[model samples]
Target: MNTLTVYKLGRVEYEDGLTLMQRFAEARKQELIGDSLLLLEHSPVLTLGRGAKRENVLASDELLASEGVDLYQTNRGGDVTYHGPGQVVGYPIFLLPKERQDVRRYVRDVERCVIDSLAEYGLHAGIIPKWPGVWLGQEGAPDTRKIAAIGIHISRWLTTHGFALNVNTHLPHFNLIVPCGIREAGVTSMKRELGHLVSVPDVEDTLARHFCSVFESERRESGVSVRTVSITVLRGHGPEARVLMVRRIPERGGFWQTITGRVEPGESPEQTAARELKEETGLDVPVRALDYRHAFALGEILPPMLVEETAFVAWCPEGHEVRLSAEHDAHEWVSPNTALERLEYRGLREGVKRAVALRGELTGG
Candidate 1:
């Protein structure tokens, strides 16, 4: 019973996160590092997997770029696919004995995470034995939707470039390319399937729990952790109001340093942030007056999703009661000072400061 190290990074575009996970997995295999998982969301990118055909990408490179899309090649086992805003992608890097290697089993476990997550929002998902990933509705249901899609790469028994769950995703983004090389297979998000908005944190929480449960049961169970931190500004009675020092969420608790989720079509980042905050922490806060303007990296660590991100600053109600959506088990409100001490990321802390500063400077601090 050793503590499994779970490292959660946030708001990384598709390719950067994917590339880091792959490299991390390789490093873990090279040196016997304990089990670890990297969870985050990606920007828009059209990724072609090992089995993908170039024809699956209908848009030319120049055209895709003009429309803010990226293309990439991945080692994962699948064909052409799209990863953009509103999707959560996970990569778990671990080591396994030769006999413990099971590709199909590992993939099914990833799909299970999506299924369990979808069920939390009252959407039941199943698998089409003929295909991988989780399917929407029952086997014979008409107008079935895809709740989640999983494509991964496993090397020397380690895994990377995991599942992508369409939560509050923009479905039109998929029209630019043929998803998973299936010309007719349509893509759907949780919000789309449910006919309303769902919380990203809620989906992420369910997915994380499912990932831990399935992955642990099949292999050397490692550690699972979760945490909460707030980024705030520190001001004294003077003109020099300083941005609060950011802390790192302990490695013992899963760390989600960057909290950027996708804006479902028609939704602004402020609206999405407010909704996501409410879903993760039960509260109603108006995003209308909140500051909106921040920089985010726009590129899939894969093929296409090299788009620019428009950021926003969300302000919660002063004393609102928090109803923990099934997504977060615990919550805390800390100043940037405490956040920097408690959160496990250094670079992301700086990003938060820059984001906060940008919001203030642009909107009149």
Candidate 2:
């Protein structure tokens, strides 16, 4: 048995993540490294597997860019799937021992690790007869929600491109594509079902521990990681109402988007929203926090990390003129759909939709 060294690399960009796992996998095959478990997060990216269909991806490049999502192709054994912040991705570099070279058994054991780990939180998860991965609900129900996804690529008995478990993952992001090219079952997350935030670190550690037990190995952890925070401000009411959107300066990824800004240390997302609204739009109005939270991965800047962003809605007093901040060069008041057209993530879009849908009730109009 070998020590299952685990590294908690916060949020690696998809390409970098792939390269990292590949390096470890190669080392394992050459007997230069012990069995290893790489646990981390990836910024929003859709990966296509062998036989993956093009139509599986419903969002165009412009749409994905507006949402800050990326797409890639991989050799993993599945269709198209997504990964992002608030999700824990595990890549195991384990060389099959003489007595345990069965691929089917290996997949089952990997699934069992997830099943047992989820049970720690009182969740009952299991495998579908043919669908693979961990799921809830009746065995034959095609529409059951899947909380975890597994797609591995094995070479010379070594494995990579492992599992993705939705911890506090934004399930709406799955709407960007037909997950694993499956229109049958739906997608879900631990936070969505539990109705609370599950510490993502706890989920990662639990997964490492379970994989060690399942693979008959000990554990070693590397670098500690933390999460980033941000906020979004959507203005106006529903279908007919217009929401305020701002265009960032070229240096800040110049794009038309909702008023967005990062949360400073010791600041709550609500506070960040208000501050961003005032700073980006000069809107001194109090913002009503929407019941919306979504996360995505960003590695473009140094020390890539995952960010959890919350949305807020503000109603300006009539006659408020445009005041542009240095961060944004231009601003516009557009319909909800127009605002969302330049936005990605399903959760954030849905938040906008819900805010507009409840406008009548929210304002008693």
Candidate 3:
């Protein structure tokens, strides 16, 4: 029987958790690790997703600091949200199987998981097709309140950034931010609905069960086998610091990553990779001319349907001016020294190091 890689934790450090999750998804896709789950909690903090409006967060920096809460702009969907001691943040980095990889469907499925889990506690939940989360009670019920939030980004059909369910939330902390930017609609919690705090293990178990059911049905229907890509580091160059990396969008959040895309039907992997680079970043360099191929997986913390990814490298440096497509938001010409420090994926970093090392060897630098 196929199984998921499950990780459990209490409080993950705020600064690194989001990046780690992004890397995990990328590594899984690049390396092909099977379904994986990263179960963890966040410190008292506020996070703003891609569409989040900064003005929605009403508190001043001094005020937030006084309350021991930190604000962060994230790559996920939705508006401002608060994470505290009791919320169980489940990042399910799963490949979207061939049969069930639709982004909209994946979002609905996550809402279903949360709704099903809530049902176990005698709470009825529903989804507002116009809104992207699970809500308490049935549609049109006065009790409706968002119970969970979903947002994601996919590279090569692999996913990253996932759902956050308010298990035993600290409601007061939420007051500072406009949850999902919806001032009229309130955010609900398991504690609020159940009148008691729910255990993280219990919630985790429920989520696992729902996910297994969702994927099992998918696997039976479509035969895409999933795998988690393991992370490997290759040493090269000076300062032990110089590295090259490729990261999925939004997790590198505000930074620009080299163009990346999935293989299309009848498309060669190299062709797809080269095309995506041009489409996403607008650097029209030929794939044959640049660097070397470094392959890895963006693991299963994603849509739970996508499978397989192989990445290769080709550099377009300072001499070039890029014409980026709308798929990407920005671009930059970063040096290998800076690239090593700034780029996100472990495998991509290693690939950069290898490229730099080879360039020096060929030039006798």
Best by lDDT: 2
What would the TM-scores of all predictions be? 0.59, 0.62, 0.58
Best by TM-score: 2
- Tens digits of per-residue lDDT for model 1, 1-365: 32245444556655456545655665576664656666666667888889988988888888897766778888888887777667777676667556548887777767777787777777778898866678875555566557577787776677777778888888888888777766545778877777888776666666667666765532232221212222232232123333323222454244444343456667755667666656655545543322222222232222122222333344544445556554344555555555556544333454455555655675476
Q: How many backbone clashes does candidate 1 have?
A: 35
Model 3 bad stretches (over 4 Å): 138-142, 217-365
Off by over 4 Å in 1: 97-99, 138-142, 217-365
Q: What are the clash counts of all predictions, listed in order?
A: 35, 2, 45
| Candidate 3 to native Cα RMSD, angstroms | 15.1
Per-residue lDDT tens digits for candidate 3, residues 40-80, read: 67767888888988999999999998887878887777777
Tens-digit lDDT track for model 2 on 1-365? Answer: 56888877766667767766766666677677788787888878999988689899999999988887889999998889999989999888788887888888888988999999999998898888768688987666765889999998887787888899999887788999998877888988899778899999899889888998988887886553332223344444444577677788999878776666777778887787788778777788777766655444454422223355566767776678868899888888778768789765454565665566556577664
Give the clashing residue pairs of candidate 2, or none: 43-297, 238-356
lDDT of 3: 0.64
